[model samples]
Structure formats: C-alpha cells, structure tokens
Target: MNGTWLTVLMAVPLVGAAVLAVLPRRIDGNLAKQVALGVSLVTLVLGAVLAFSFEPGGGYQFTVEVDWISAFGAHFALGLDGIGLALVLMTVILAPVVILASWNDADPVDAAVAPGRSPRWSTHSFFAWVLALEGLAIGVFAATDVFLFYVLFEATLIPIYFLIGGFGGPERAKAALKFLIYSLAGGLIMLASVVGLYVVSADSSFGPTYLLSELQQVDIATDVGRWLFLGFFIAFAIKAPMFPVHTWLPDAAAQGTPGTSVLLVSILDKIGTFGMIRFCLTLFPEASEWATPVVVVLALISIVYGALMAIGQDNIPRLIAFTSVSHFGFIVLGIFVMNSYGGSGATLYMFNHGLSTAALFLVTGYLIKRRGSAQISDFGGVEKVAPILAGILLFAGLSSLGLPGLSPFVSEFLVIVGSWQYAIWVAVIAVTGIIWAALYILLMYQRTMTGPTRPEVAGMSDLKVREIVALAPVLVLILGLGLFPKPLLDVINPAVEDTLVFVDGASVEPVATAVDDATAEEGDN
Candidate 1:
C-alpha cells in the first residue's frame, strides 16, 4: 500500500465514476446517489489510510513511477509530498460533502434551477462528473512528472466543464463556456512552456526528461528560464483568477450549483497556487524571486479588488466567489513572499480556505434552494425563522472574515506575519483586505440573516438533518483546526523548509515581531 497508495487513492474514484457511467440510465437516482456517496466515502477512507501511512517529515512518500511517453520522456509518475498531501486530504474530504450537499441538486423537478431553465443531465451524470473531477484533482496533486501533471491538469477541465454547463442556474452553459475558454487559453499558453522544457531537457546531458526531479537539475540560462516561467505563471494566474484575468469566476459561481462551486473554488482553484509553489518557484527559483515585486503587487490588487467586489454583490453565490478571489490573493501573496511563515501559511491556507469556502457555499446554497433565489434582496431575518440555518451561516461567515478561533485566522495571520517580514507596506495593504472581508461577510450576513423577516422567507425551513450532517464536519474542522493547527503545521513546516532551499540555500525561519525578541531577551536576563 505504501508504494501503490497514490495509485490506489487516485484509481478508486475514477473507477467509481466509470462504473456509474456504465450503469443503466433507468436506474434510480437515489441508488445512483448512494453509489456515488458510498464510492466517495470509500475514497475518503483510502485518503485517510494514505494520510496515516504518510511519514510527515519525509519527502515524497507513496511514490509510483512507470514510463508512459518515452519520446517526450514523460512517465505515469505519482508522489505525495506534504504539500500534495494537504491538498489531497482537502480534495477527498470535500468530495463526499459536495456529493451529500448536492443530493437533490440535479433532480430535474425536485432541484431548483434558474428560472426558465432545467437540469441538462441526470443526477448520476452530475455525480459521475464530480467523481471524475475528484480523481483527476488527486492526480493533479500527486503527479511528479511535469507532463503527467499537465495532462491531469488539463483533463480536470472536462468533468468540471460538464458540471458547470449541465447543472445549476440558467446561464450555466455560458458560464461553463467562459470557464473552459479561460482555462484552455491558460493551458495552451503553458503548453508552449512545456514544449520549451522538453527542448531544454533534450539539449541537456539528461537527454529529454519531463520528471520534475530531473528538470530541477538541468539549469537553463536566466533569460530562457524567465520566459518559461512566465508561460506557467500566466496559466496559474488565470486558474487562480488573479486580478484582470479573474472575470470568469463570479459568473461561474453564481451560475453553478453550490456543490459545483465548492469543487471549483475550494478543490480545483488550489491547483493554481499548488502549481505556483510546485512548478513556478521550485523549477524557476531565480525567476520567481525576480518576479516577486510584480507578483506581490498583483496579489495585493486581487485582495483589494476581490473584497470590494464581494462587498457589492447582490447575488449570494457570486459574492462567495469574489470572496475566494480575495482569499486566493492572500494565498498567492504568501507564496511569493518566499519565507517559511509565508510558504507554510500559504500551503495551510489552501486547506483552511477550502474548509471555509466550502462551508460558505454550501450553507448559502441551502439558503438559495429554500428561498428559490440567490439574490440578497430575497432573504431577510432568516434567523427569525430558521435559527439553526442562520447560526451555521454566521459561523461560516465569521470563518470567512478570519474571525479568531476559526481555522482561517491562523493561516491568515501567518501570511500577514510572513508578508510583514517581506515588506511592511505589503503586509499593511494586505491587512486592509481583511477589513474588506469583514464588511462583505458581515454585511451579507446582516442583510440576509438578521433583518426583519421578509414575508416570503417567514416560513423558511431550517437545515434538514442531512444538511446538518453535511455541514457538521466543516464547522467542526473550522473551529477544531483553528484552536489546534500544530499537527498540520508540523507536517507542512518541513516541506516549506525543503521548498525554500531552492530559493534560499538555508531554511528561512518565520520572522518574529520585535516585541517577541525583546521579551525573549528580558526572560533570558
């Protein structure tokens, strides 16, 4: 299991999806839902086994390598470093949550569709696509070969494309198309760099290798490396949907189902930052440092811009989407700051943000489904009628705002502290985004959950048992990890240190405040 763990972890879901795909269309939706749920649960268990089997300070455990495309020097290679493990955990955890939350999301009659539109696929197809996306996402995280990673990365677009287009609001088709175009545009741009890498490797003593380990060893001149870096960075930026290139997200989030939004924003978007740390920084360290000033500025802009947009959104799902944009900014900022605190925090942020955003999307999704509207204007004083639902929304909203005693705060603090070491002004400006976060999250909560009960929402039902079951784990993790993130940090810190060796020869320590140094000196005296 140790050697084959990653392969088994990835195969379970893909195989489950295939089985569901081949099942008769006349099969009951409940059965399909159960099968999907059961399969996802199994995957989650396998994920747990992988987690337990993982030796935390160790690098790249559960690795499997086999030659695939020898001409291009690609292989069916998979491995899990701590960074990849964190993401894989998030992916597996979110799979069943999304499946459960979306239980009725694709029902042609029972599920709510945007006015005048209907579900374009069966419930089974929706679940199957989700399973496929999960499997591909795991592949994306675990792939050690650059070409293998790229293939899995591009392959992810297919299931998600269908997930967005076939289900959710009336504009899903248009939203899905926009997502595909942006993603494909990015992928195509990265392909040039991929080819360049092959070209670079071909000329080297290694004689054509696409393995990340081997690529890191073959040093090209600074000019060629920077150009190659740009190709990959631009693709990741679009996927991260950073400022200027981020327009596709709100539309897709608003138009897609909550589960689709969760999978898209929470699990899928991590690929961007994951690639940044894994590919951009590791493979092109000098270029990364050279690119930092501009990248930091872009990250700052994304933070401010995304927050402001979220504050102004009338639509709930779109609002959540914009908040993710803001959060992704923090994650990206941490990555580029190039310190232990920033890198570790950024990696952890990928996991924490997934939990926070999934909670927000799913709980808000319940609201939309009940009210039959995603518009903020349609909901008021939901707490007056459904306190449980309102309470859960409040918890989710607070987590998004980086409220204390929640998971996001710890990671966000680390990023800010890390950024402060990089530049005081950058951290200050980044902090302002947290202010905007408060406004958007609190204002949305106030408007939708705390005002006088709207007549239409007066009889709104509270969260159902299944809804509670779905959200319970998310809320618990938010608070649990908030109070105690050491276990994760222990695993993540070593990986951060290792990654930093590429940029800085020595492990960069997390910078402490002046007061802390002074206090330590005083204690010593």
Candidate 2:
C-alpha cells in the first residue's frame, strides 16, 4: 500500500506476469495474446490514473514512501516529477503496442526450438516478462530512493538480456551474452561508486546513504566526485550504448524478434540517458561540470561514427541499430550540457525517440515476417501495397530526421539551443550530427520503401487490422507530441530546472538562472 499510486502503475505489470504464470498451459495463442493484452490495458489504465493525478504544478504528487530497509535508509520511495511522469507514461504506451504488433507473428526462436511448444506459453512468457520489465522500468524512473532506484535500474537488464538471447534470431546467444557482459560490467562498476558515495559520507556521523537526495548533500572533494561520477556515467553510457561500448546493441537488435528489439532499444536503452539525468546530475554536479568536455567529445564521435556505420548496412535491422548509436550520442550531448534546456530536451527526446524508433522497428518487423528476411534489398514499393504501414514509416522516419513539427525536432532544438550558452563550439560540432540524421534516415527510406517491388515483396499483404491497431498509438503520439508538446514540456521543465540548480554554487548564479529561465520559456511552448 505504498500510497505512491505510481507504484500501482508499476506493479500491475508484475501482477499480470504472475497471473500469466498460472494460466492454463493449454490456452490458445489468441487467448494468450488476449490475456497479455488485458494486462497491458490494465497497466495502461492504472498508468493513466497515476498520470491524471499528476499536478503539473503540484510537485511530486502520488508519492509513496515507506521503510524498506532501515539500516540502508532506503525507503520504498517512488514519485513523479514531470520528466519522470513522461518516461513512465511513454513506457506504458510502448508495451501494448509492441505486444499487439507481434501478436499473430510467430515467435521466431520459439518456433525453431520447440515446434511442439504451445504458442500460448511462448506468448504468455513473453508478455509476462515484458510486464515484469515494464514494472521494473517504471520503478527505475519513479523510485526516489537511490538504493531502490539502483535495484530497479539493475533489475531491468536481466529480463531484456534474456528476451534477446532466449528468443531472438541466429546469433541470439552471442548477442544476449554480449549485452549481459557489458551491462553487468557497467552496473558492477556503478555499484562501487554507489558504495563509495556512502562510505564517503560516513564521517558525517550519519555515515553514507544511497538515497540520492541524501548523497547530494554529502559533498565530496572535487577530484573524488569526478572519479565517482565516471563510474555512474560509464555505466549509463554503456546503457546509452554510446560509442565503442555501443557495439552490443546492433547485434542484439538484429538478432532479437521485433518485439524484443522494441523493448530493448526503445524503453530499456533509455535507462542509460535517464540515469545520466537523475543520478549523475543530481549526485555529482561538480563532476558533471568537469566531465562536460570529455562527454561532448565522445558524443560527437558516436554521432559521426554511428551515422557513418549506418550508411553501410545492408541489414535493415542493423542499420536501425547504427542510427540508435548516433541518436543516443545526441541524448548524451543534451545531458552534459548542464542546462535546463539541454536536460529537459534530452528527457523529452527519450520519449520521442522511443515511440518513433519502436514504430520503425515494429513496421520493419512486419515486413521481415512477410518477406522472411530483414534485408533492405528485400523491400521496395512497400507503400503501394501497404500505404498505412508505409505512411507510419514515413512519419516516423521524418521525425527521426528531426523534421519540423515532429517530436525529435523540438527536443533537439532545445538541446542545441540550451547548450549554446555554455558550450558554443561543442554545440557547433554536434550540429553536424543533426545534418547526418537527415541524410541517413532519408537514404534508408528511399532505399527500402520506394523503387519497384522485389520479387519477394510484390505479393505481400498489407497490414492486418491488429497490426494497424498496433501502429496507431505510436503514430498518434509522434504527431501528438510534435504538434502539442506544451503540456509535456510544462511538466518536464520544472523538474529539469530543479536538476540544473546546483548546491551552494551561487557565484555562478546569474548564468545558470538565465539558462534556467530560458528553458522555462522554451518549455512553455
């Protein structure tokens, strides 16, 4: 009964998973699909309720706090600020859509492994794990206690790692194992930092605590803070899948079924950037300032490196994977800019990128299912046959390219504009990535969606009614958020402003306040 109604929003998915576990083993595929759908619907409804109660003006409403471990001072703390609310809502939005998209599609891995295994359990297990994942993911955003946050944060990796490895394509095991090694290695490193933060606080009589709010108060020396922040940053960057460390993501995405890819890249990968905002900015302000140059430099490399690699991919899924590396570089850029515009813009981008990217993956998955291959050459004149699917792709593609009036455009604008005040040269270099975004995205669209139909694609059926339903919400959100983002920005701004406000650093006040005020103005739009 953590009054944190947000907890219920998170827990419904978990409860659904448990119910799914005991569902009659003999259930049909359609019934299994329906049950998962029901669970997602319930989670969505509960999420709406939690969202409804959110006071854009009322700070941290629907909060639930209780003692979970007294010794650790970790209350089962959870609540929503505007930014957290958006991510939570977006996560809920993605689950049902991904589920619906793949409802009738065969579990590629399942079909290969146990042809006799009921689709019901395969479907059942998939959704159950998804719900469990959704619950944990939302908890990561909502949890106010740092210890609880880390647990939820780290917990998310297991389900998705399995999702990709256990039920993905030919290289599933290798891709999954790579993902596990990278993520666990990052998490383990961050854990030491988490412990270091606590141990560093021990001299204050209360010792150190993992409560982010508490840790924020126990000032470490500037050098110690930088080292500590790197632990957190490196972990998140791997999650962000920023360059060099990002190699695992493409393989995972290409190997996993479309639904699994959507969850892994769309929602789960966001944990990295989200971690940057909540943990890094909140706990290690001095370190964040110090790391700005290096962070932005790496972001540029990801931007340039990822885009360049994307252009060379014949595998459609792998191309999308490369694009993500580039896009994530922007997300990381927005973060280290250390201003509200950059921070809030980065936050909103997390939601925008998820829907748009999910749309692309799901649509591509539909094509892959019909064609038996995920090659770019396997598609052509897709619009002639499936105008709706083609149209969703166009819109999503344009949004990813940062076309005006689309979601990514707004967020990227904010990030670049906000960063200009503090890091003008870096902002200039990052702008090149924006140009590359358009180039790669459009090139991809032209190659796959146009031209005469390939022999394999000519006879393909258009989207099924359920598939249309699956794609609809994402289309609506991409456009909706693009057209009328003010409400969301309003919620995101205050929290972002709070994020940029540093402790006891009043001498640098004027510039920060100016940046904060400007971000508020931008958010008002």
lDDT of each: 0.92, 0.80
Q: Please give the RMSD of candidate 1 to the true structure.
A: 2.0
Candidate 2 lDDT for residue 224: 85
For 1-525, candidate 1 gives per-residue lDDT tens digits of 565878988999999999889889998989889999999999999999888888877998898889999999999999988899999999999999999989998888633344634788888899999999999999999999999999999999999899989986778888999999999999999999999999999998888999999999998899999999999999999999799899999999988889999999999999999999999988999999889999999999999999999999999998999999999999999999998889988999999999999999999999988998899988899999999999999999999999999999999999998899899999999999999999999999999998789999998999999999999888999999999988788778778877888895434763333336778999999
Clashing pairs in 1: none
Query: What is the clash count of model 1?
Result: 0
Best by TM-score: 1
Q: Give the poorly placed runs of model 2, Cα more than 4 Å off.
A: 106-121, 503-525
Pairs of residues at least 3 apart in sequence or in different chains that clash in candidate 2: 4-64, 202-207
Task: Tally clashes: model 2.
Answer: 2
Where does model 1 exceed 4 Å of error?
Answer: 110-114, 505-507, 510-525
RMSD each, Å: 2.0, 3.6
| 68: Cα error in model 2, Å | 2.0
In candidate 2, what are the lDDT values of residues 77-166, reduced to their tens digit? Answer: 887888788989999999999878877544434556434222332666777777789889989988888888888888998788767765
**Maximum-lDDT candidate:** 1
